[model samples]
Target chain A: MSTDSPIDATRPIALRAVRGFHVGGRPVDLVDLPHRQLATVPGLQPRVSNPNGRYQVGQLYVQQFALAAPTARYPLLMWHGGGMTGATWECTPDGRPGWHDYFMRKGYDTFVSDAVERGRASWAPACLVSEMPEHRTLEQAWDIFRFGPPEGYGAANGKRQAFQGQRFPVHALDQLAKQFVARWTSTGGMALDAYVELIRRVGPCTILAHSEGGRLAQHAALSVPELVKGLILVEPAGAPSTAVEDASRLRGIPHCVLWGDYIPQNSLWTIYRRQVDEWLAAVQHAGAEVTEFDLPAKGIRGNSHLPMMDDNNWLIANLIHEWISGAMEGGMSG
Target chain B: MSTDSPIDATRPIALRAVRGFHVGGRPVDLVDLPHRQLATVPGLQPRVSNPNGRYQVGQLYVQQFALAAPTARYPLLMWHGGGMTGATWECTPDGRPGWHDYFMRKGYDTFVSDAVERGRASWAPACLVSEMPEHRTLEQAWDIFRFGPPEGYGAANGKRQAFQGQRFPVHALDQLAKQFVARWTSTGGMALDAYVELIRRVGPCTILAHSEGGRLAQHAALSVPELVKGLILVEPAGAPSTAVEDASRLRGIPHCVLWGDYIPQNSLWTIYRRQVDEWLAAVQHAGAEVTEFDLPAKGIRGNSHLPMMDDNNWLIANLIHEWISGAMEGGMSG
Candidate 1:
């Protein structure tokens, strides 16, 4: 179902639609395309997307678009937290203006992508494990490149570790670690030397993450240091933990944190403390400025986890704009 | 099935248990208990009710327990915000020691209740016309003095009001004004002196509200000033169209303003000009001291309408205790 390194023809056609740039504000069609494609609904307005250049790279499929004026040199790729698809960025629950416009007007071309391990991936986990032949469960989701499906769960044999209700036999972290290792192994495990090469190829960008996607952002940052300049995370689920120590060592890259007052702590909350501690230490280690934010309380449909979708989310919009301005401007002084 | 006044005797008994200072440190039994309804799963721990007393007069059905000191005036009420019934206060979502024990040791008696309103009489709407007496449609829940169902809904021939989402065929104010007229007519069209006499019987107490309930609280204040003393609303919602002029002209009582941020034109995000022209003027007219609180943003949930339920909700708890503690402390300095 998947071919490594072979380009998909759809990438160019999508790219053309995005490049057209509706100066007159022509109606752009973001029709919920197949396999996690976004579409424009009647009551819903389209926020942002790049049909072109937005292509699938191996297992990971990404949608990228260039933002309008006041553009930043580094691109911004926004991701949905876990249990949420990229569509979360496209429409309000009741079908209204997506936050995509907020970033675009501010001049950051945004990209929302799917994590390669689940959901719309064409290859099933069963099939995916076949290639590298060592993956199992949500944990093995990370190991396609380095080890086979962790011990017992792997085709004939891969170790299994399941905690909570996770169907995966391995620890989520263990799987993630092995997956990164697999990716490294596939590329000859050159570590930073090759990671820097990929970073340069992917170009410069900052990550805007929510919920579980925050964890992915942390991993991406740790794996590829030079590619990232800053991180704008909103109530990211799993963060900083021990990973924060690694993330902080990346040197002067700024980290902005926005957490909700009533937000329930999960792995994310744990990460918040870890990341902040790591950051404080990281700054001490690297001698960089650290910025942190705590969002005031508000209920979105009586639920407190999803902040961007809060009925009274205008505060966040202002804060985002301010944070971006501070970040873009602060870079000069730093 | 319900009657007016506090029917504590006939109602079932309810107990609130915490992890540290439980009944012999054993779990609580919450069956057929007089006001102690388990809105959540039985095995789950009980949390404190709102300290700010927002979100459905949440404090009304509290289960009070003795503190370690046995002689504390202001007992701490553990409140969990939306979604969570009240278990959130005892332990973090992942189950760890929360604020209850921390405060109990500090010599504060603790109380616990649920913010959920489906079963509470306090949440019943103030003014809806309906044939059937459902929970809070519009009609006063009961003739409180009579301790029986009111004449309108109880009567088989009662006229019903239409429910059109947030819209209504009748304006609440106009309806209230008409009720004033009808109530007057039914009472032989009494004069202003008689009206004042009737309202005085309504008695004294303060109301605190959050989110949508805030609008209702304001309406209650505007309509029945005799029944309220210094309204303490936490982000109440109301239309400026009807409330502005009246609120501005109002006099005597204090209004406390607590909001995170303000964006132009949003009903939630009123401009300063509007605030001065409308709300602040009303507060001045009422002659109330206005205390503005901009709480810390971190760990804040989507429940902004409910500042009293934050993890650090003691912020407002202390504020409330300040007001409540007044007469008890120095016998009215004013």
Candidate 2:
């Protein structure tokens, strides 16, 4: 009953498919979830559970939403910023609030998984669709995604002080990203499988990430180039210059990374120069295909590391709507 | 009727447009064409000209076919390759045999204007378009498009000795393209204006250029980046690669360059490494918005330059259909 996504016009539809292997569990199948039954609401709220019990993948939880289209291509797997959880994207009861309604109406199967210790769905760790993507420990992963303190910042703060840690914040981001991608591929099927089955089932999926999650998306796309056709990042703190090199390696892969801050007072504005420089460099290498739009426009947010929620919610809704329309139109598997 | 266009479905549509200009002398508009009226003959041979001389421009002619859905956003403006006339595209009497028909049945307004000297609309003296593009030129107008010799193979044949005498082939091509675009824009505010005006009376407008014509389309797109929204090029030739330095020049613009080689002899395998090298290099600069796809396999003479008449014509026809369908459905505008 709310619109927190880019796609919000085609309501009352669902997009479902085999999400992943259920290995020792129920086969994972994701389906379009509606906002509210309107008359009979499905009590499916934020709930945390160890999808993988033995592994202390921290805490895991499932974030569900009704899909707008009956059929979908790729599922948009959302990864919230650091110190945030799935509940960060909430909708008003009237369906004027979250991304679920937006994408559902436009015809995509939407799902948001969260980790523990956040607002909602924090009782459990995020889904491991696979193993711990190569990193032996979570700290290393933290170092890769920029939520870790930037270089030159106090080493006393939560940050990686190893290996030329004296580098500039932007420079450090690239090296950190390399580490994450290296780990992701070494164990996460680097070139093992194309995850073709996943794509065939969902359609042509794209990863949506924010902040630290940006590091993960970058790794996955690079680790499994064949599987990722595109990427949609929101105010991502990607390696300022490294993305250009990273994007170059991607070749045919397309990308839309949004960042920039209208409000100079906002901390996000701090990395604006670095982010833009990196994006422009990537654009030079990849051309119009690898893009960075001026999406400084605010977007949907919740009680989390929120965007300018008030100025952005609708624009975010529009994005979801367009995404659904484009994806569902069929045959743009690229 | 014939299938050389996408203007009328039931009747064998003519490609003639109302051109106030002349060819050599007599009015460009035809009062009576040789093939406009013909009785049902024994063998079945209907010429591809129109009665109204208003369709001829310079050494060019016209062909039109009705689209399946009149609500099409853009009427496809088709320009054929070298040494080929409008008739070369047709297969059967009731139409549906050429690429032009495939698009029309799918609801796209179709029109084909002949090239000046059996090459492209912009060829030789009265060529329809040009292709040369340099940083200086781009800076002159911030060119969004350019046309010229398809990354050529003059080296193999030693065919180019002086670029038509001192004028680099690239420069000559771009100049032709520049003039063509100037005419189109000046006459109707961009080639799509008349087509769009006509279609708006009906719906939207797009473009489809084959072989040499493909180059013209590219040039047109560059001439008025804001005006031309989408393009479909058929086995285009002479796509000069933008050197690394040049690569830095092209920052914005979307391109959908469709390549096909139905014959194995004409396969991408046969494509020169030099051409590929430059293409890739330039693409590196272009980025992800461009979509490149391989066409069905065929032979050595399988390209747009001199596609073996008869069956190979399907290559262009199929491309046109897909291009129009692509533009109409995808609406790759801006």
Candidate 3:
């Protein structure tokens, strides 16, 4: 549609109202230390813990984009993947207006949230100490996600080659690379629990989950189905197992599984797809309406693991808008 | 490097000089019909074949972008893939300046050409009669290239899903879909032969070939090594075989094989990579300065098969420029 010039028109127009807030934080006891006494000691350099060490855990950071006249029955909530923040939906790595604003423009109140200990949800020392986490380097992402040539970087060799039709903006790769934060192995459960709580407070709504956020979405939907009306899963890292009881509880609720290009070659993604398929099958058998969206089948190409942050993200957003509108038109409780 | 704003700065500046011309065309006799008799007939108006019909089997079309003070010692000849015109190197599908302009800006005389029976090289009836060809549908590309979800299009399903990280410009997808020309199975050999001839005429240049264009580049390099100073292969469809004789002839020749992302998942590309590896092995054994660029290895991600028309095409062009300059600095003979 943008033939004369290539520009990102995905940014949402200024909404009637926008707000930011914190959700689901629990208070912690203060830690008292001999700060003055330690400082008085001559030779040894004194270190003191903050006198107000009282902190919050399981709290999340959320930014809401509200439309004055909502078109949909329920607000759309966006949950980010692991080691990421609410920023995932705020603006694209390429600096385009992200899904948060796009969905807002579509007349749906949009809520973007960062999970416990990620992004704006500052983590407590207890949560961080549970397991040592590692930061993912840009090189690791390049290879794992099949972004470009698999080798050659460092002073000896310059930047490696990117894949031929990758949708992620390689020009802004450095900016995107900075978004990969340290992730912990034990944080999934905590994040999911917090997300479920957030859903309860927000009331019934449609949820869009990506990667690790899939777990939270699934858990919340199952644990409190009353709060969730629909599910849009974009390459979820894991899916609800057949072992999940009362799959029928999700009956009548619309669920769509979205897959991008290059899934077969990615072992991890293949496994994830298998799990998702199995889960979707179980849900279907349980009488829930399950739809599978294979991007390649629809004539869309060259998408990576992070479709929301991709260059063609607007197209994906359009697709989501249509699906969401259709689902909500039937009534949010359907 | 562009962090403040994400803009495609790949567009080329107005060149100091530019020109276009046709190569490898020959005279053909025009068919003459009995004008009076043909006009008398209603439905079957005229049908006559010239007794002296002379046709050119393999001619091509070329456009050259020249710089007054070229930095590189040799010119860069760009050969497009199957069913594609020289436009592949002219501008990106996302509206960025393509490799043709990018390399020209780097101070090299760049030549982009259409192969026999492709684009500007209109084919004769004889070529068409050689074999039946099939036009690639958007559906086929969506699946084969791993562009989008592998299912859902047409009336049955209104829209399809895009892959997560695909880099192809989805907004311009319909426009790009129109670019998929019908490809004949039997035309490969003809195109390769014509390309080799073109190389001989051009003399001492660097060839940048993509996908199907790789075959022509390899054939030309092997048949007439003297004309080729350096080789830059960008995701060539096929690689050389072990059967190559006198492999040492390419010894000391600077050859760089650049691969984009998302190859492992695509079967055809996987096979292509294997073959390319075999050829690279042989080339190395023969002592050529062979450089393999695995984009993912270098931390570049989300590339599709058509890097030249991708969003980061300028980056790929920049890489080619560096390699060419380095190769030329050591002497074009290498």
Overall lDDT per candidate, in order of appearance: 0.35, 0.36, 0.62
- Residue B169, candidate 2: Cα error in Å is 73
Candidate chain B TM-scores, in order = 0.38, 0.46, 0.84
State the TM-score for model 2.
Answer: 0.30
Cα lDDT, model 1, residue A98: 41
lDDT of 1 by residue, A24-60 (tens): 0011122233232222111123213222111111233
* Estimated TM-score for each candidate: 0.32, 0.30, 0.46
For model 1, state the Cα shift of residue B235 in Å: 58
Off by over 4 Å in 1: A1-58, A68-70, A119-200, A240-248, A264-285, A297-303, A331-334, B1-334
User: What tens digits encode model 2's per-residue C-alpha lDDT throughout A1-334?
Assistant: 2233334243223222111110011112222322211110011222121121122112223333323233446666565554333323433212133454444444445555442222211111123333222111223232332233334233566454532221113322322121111012222121112122223333456666666455445555655656665666666644434623465555655666655333233344345435545654664476535455454434322211223132355565465335433533334321
Which candidate leads in lDDT? Answer: 3
Candidate order, TM-score descending = 3, 1, 2
Better candidate number, 2 or 3, judged by lDDT:
3
Off by over 4 Å in 3: A1-16, A30-47, A50-53, A126-128, A152-157, A331-334, B1-334
* Residue-wise C-alpha lDDT for candidate 3, range B1-334, written one tens digit per residue: 2132122334223322333334554434324422221111111223222222223445665655555456678888898876555656644545555566556556677777767655435444332245433434455566555566555223245655656576666555544543443355455666767787778777888888887787568767888887788888888767656675566767666788888777766676787778778777888798888887787898877767777666666676666666776654563221
Interface alpha-carbon RMSD, every candidate = 29.8, 34.0, 30.1
Better of 1 and 2 by lDDT: 2
